[model samples]
Target: MTSHHPAPRPARPVADLFSADGRLKAIPRKPARREALLAHLAATLFEDGRDYREPEVNEALLAVHEDFPALRRYLVIGGFLGRTKDGSTYRRQQQPGSPGGAIFAVA
Candidate 1:
């Protein structure tokens, strides 16, 4: 018997998650969808090889949501963002070009 996995489709645009003025309507409730949304934020907001101070991180995140701390925590827990043990600096994690050229389906 053979087990076959379906090919991964491209990630959908998460624009709907945000309002016209570009603030999030709400953080997504489901984990997978949330991660995808965070990935979009991580990619767009942070630059590579640059470290952001906590204030800078907060300011950027606040532009997206008033609950910046929760968004920060979620981004860290989801591996979309990283920080030092002292929590003084934050940076976006480098994501690989879709491993196996696919994202595993999550429900």
Candidate 2:
């Protein structure tokens, strides 16, 4: 006798995670989804090779979600954004094998 299993659901597109007004409904709990969200945020919200102050970062993040702090922390922790020792500045991490430190890609 053979056992049957259901096929897995396809992952939601990153754009679907956001609300109609463009705010992220919530930070994804799943690791892969979260990473994709962070990468999308990093690519769209930040420019390459430009350093940003804490408030600047907050301003940009706030445009997407009210919980900028959590978003900020996740960005840093996920290796998508880099912060200074004292957390005074942040910059988007470059994509691997990209010349002149280009913006990171999602996949």
For candidate 1, lDDT tens digit of each residue in 1-107? 23363545446779999999999999988766777788888898899789999999899999999999988987776667789999999988776345531244334
TM-score for all predictions?
Answer: 0.79, 0.77
Model 2 regions more than 4 Å off: 1-11, 96-107
Output the worst ten-in-a-row residue range by lDDT, candidate 2.
96-105
Please give the CA lDDT of all the candidate structures. Answer: 0.80, 0.82
The residue pairs in collision within model 2 are none
Q: Which pairs of residues collide in candidate 1?
A: none
Model 2 accuracy (lDDT, Cα)? 0.82
Relative to the unseen true structure, what is the C-alpha lDDT of residue 18 in candidate 2, on a scale of 0 to 100?
96
Among these predicted structures, which one has the highest lDDT?
Answer: 2
> Residue-wise lDDT of candidate 2 within 23-72, one digit each (tens)?
99999887667777888999999999999999999999999999999899
